[model samples]
Target: MAVALSRRTVAKNALSQLGTFALSGGSKAIAAIMVARTLGPKGMGTFSLSWTLAGTLAFVAVLGLDNRLIRELARTRDPRELERSLPLACLLGLIFGGLLTGIPALTGVHSDAAQALAAAGGFVAVSAPILIFRATFHAREKMEYETVTCVVEGAVALIAVAVALGAGFGVGGAMLGLTAGRVANLILCLVLYRRLWGPVRIEIAARRWLGLIHEGWPLAVSYSLTATFLRFDILVLAIFHPSAEVGMYGAASVILLTAPLVAVSFSSSLYPILAQAEGLDDEHLQSVFQKTSRILIVAALPLATGLTVLATPIAEMLFGSDFGHTGRYLALLAWILPFRFVNHLFGVVLAATHRARSRRLAAVALALIANLALNLMLIPTWGAYGAVAATIATELVIAGLLLAGIRPLRPILARPLVEGALVALAMTGVVLVTPGGIFPQLATGGASFAGGLWVLFLWLPSRGLAAFSATEQESAAAA
Candidate 1:
């Protein structure tokens, strides 16, 4: 019962994180739509490229230390470690922030791209330290601070973007809005830090900092590669195609990419629990891993199905008519959601099992190389469609690699995947037949999938959803 309750607690925290992502992603999604509609394809393309550049560099600013910091804090509960890391992150932020600003200025791109990059530079500078604060909350399982900041940031972003677009500030203004939101989020996080952790410490030692970097460099490499590969297609697109085509791909990719955050939220909540786990072979760890895989499949399938079915209308409604092919791009990319979600779990599991340094890095390196090769080959011929193809193919390859490498997690996927597919197919039928807008289709699809799961798995004893809990309870009793 205690173990069951603990699992429930993990689920609760996961929900809180998911809620944070939902609100934050919602605001950003709206902001994206506003940018797309107001700016059209050319302007939207500039904004997308500029934002991706900032985000990719922000990974460098943190030195890929966020996850490692979380795991360490979860294990050690050391405040001094947190204090040391905060200043380091801020200092790196300032340095990388300069790089973000300088590159576009030096290259002499369009004024809009330059302004967007400059604003994004400010964003990186202000936002780097927030990562430390967020890791602290995540490791401690105190997500309410995150929740508060997410809401405030999202609201601020929406208002700022709306005001910018209203003022005809263009791509630069949209970028500034994003930076403004991050600034607010950073300030709020600082206040929360003081209130919860008591005071701010700003001491840094070079030797200790280098030691931390030494420990984190490998993870940094993996993370940077991961970030770059994910957005490399955009860079390629910008090179070979016009901004309008890039915008179409960007508009589609943004919506589909946000779906992975759901998996990240659940995995974040699970990480702390998994850190305390005995080993990869531990009974509780195995049970929870299987259960998590099941839950992610169940959550992701309906979303992927709905998006694939409604991609065209969603694209038309969100970005207006200028983005003619945006819906087709989204429809193709929607299939990646399930694979991406499960890959996120594979990563967390690898980290928890202490194999992240080698296996995970290898997997990401392979995928990154593949992505680059595929993009180079596909982009010139297929344009934006080529980028979509590369993304889907890369996800599938990486998912296979991760699944094959993580032996314990392999068997857990088959059942959940089979069940999820059936439910998704049923939901798709309902969605197709239902004669209404996207909202009604969404509602009915969700209802049918939910009803199908309950009836098939919960109501019927033959195919119970409680198998893991039952196994865990029995194991506990036996012990």
Candidate 2:
């Protein structure tokens, strides 16, 4: 009965995550379209660059302690210890946030509105506590609380941006609104976490603090470096290209990247389960990885295929005709989703399994080398497309290297690869027949996806797909 309840909990959590992503992703996409129209490419570019910088700084502020908190608190099952770690993590987050925000100001990059940037930085600095508190919820596996926090945060951010735009604040207004939303989220998360975790008794030990830092510092370094690689291209473009170009690239990237929400949702739902399962023997670990990989591939393939085949029409419908070229870039980027999805899953597995150091090293090295090479080779020729190419190349390298490092994960890779190819073929057939209109393209894509899923379901060994269905009592019993 407990096992049945646990399975149900996992399923419920997974569904909630999917719901949250659907809401958040839809809201964000709508917001991006509105912002793109309001600011054009240059304004969008500036916003994207600022966001990239802010996100990088946010990762720094986290110092990788978020995951540490989850692991330690989950393992220790000690609420008192978890409560104690919160303020310390927040302190570190503030210091890092201050440095991140201050560096740009001191360098005269924000020459026109240094005060506003500084204020923004301070707002971000205060955000660390919110982030740490949020991690505490994840540690306790309180998916409902986590989901509520995410949905509320996203909804607030979207509404705030719309209001800011309507009020004629433009890009800066949007950023301020975003910062405000984060602050709101931080406050809400703290209140909810306290209520959920019960009254907090704050205590700290130097040894415990150092232990978390020691475990998390490498992850922090890995996260920071990996973040740099992910966002460095935008920074490069901001330096070399016009803000309009940056905006164009940024807008298109946002649209293309939206597809990964499905993959991310799956990973987020499963990571805790995997973390708990880590104590099991090797055979059980491998079984979990295999089943998880199959589920991930099954979900990712059709989504990627649909995006690739319908990229142009989807882009136009979402962002308007003004963004036609951006649509083309989105199309090209669709191809990377399968690879990115695989990378995301394996990367989580690596981190959860304590191989994060090696994964981080490979990721950083690949990102640096790929960014330099791609920027030099493609940027002058392809502009934003060049950046996309660079991103794809870098992600592939990181995924490839990480897979090499974690040999145990290799056996699970075959099904996803095959499934992806089959879905691509089916999507190609649908695209060839579908006409130009938006509704027609969407219908065609939807039909293709449904048909492809049916075919794959019929063809793949039943054992592989069975693990995904929580209601299959017999299969559950077998597992």
Task: Note the Cα lDDT for every prediction shown.
Answer: 0.83, 0.69
Off by more than 4 A, model 1: 1-5, 108-110, 456-479
lDDT of 1 by residue, 1-479 (tens): 11232857786788888878877777777888899999899988998898888888877789866767887887788877788888888889999999877867688765887888888898888878988898888878887679889999999988999999999898889988988898999999989988877888876787798888887777788788888888999999999999999999999878876767778888767877777765566677777778788878876787788888888988888899888699899888998888888888887777666554567788888999999999999999989989988998999888987887677655466777788888888999999999878878878987998897787556765545478678889999999
Q: lDDT of candidate 2 vs native?
A: 0.69
Evaluated at residue 400, the lDDT of candidate 2 is 72
Error of 2 at 464 (Å): 11
Report residue 148 deviation for candidate 2 (angstroms): 0.6
The regions of model 2 sitting more than 4 angstroms off are 1-6, 22-26, 99-123, 204-211, 277-281, 355-366, 376-382, 431-436, 454-479
Q: Clashes per prediction?
A: 0, 4
Candidate 1 lDDT (Cα, 0 to 1): 0.83
The weakest ten consecutive residues by lDDT in model 1 span 1-10
Clash list (residue pairs), candidate 1: none
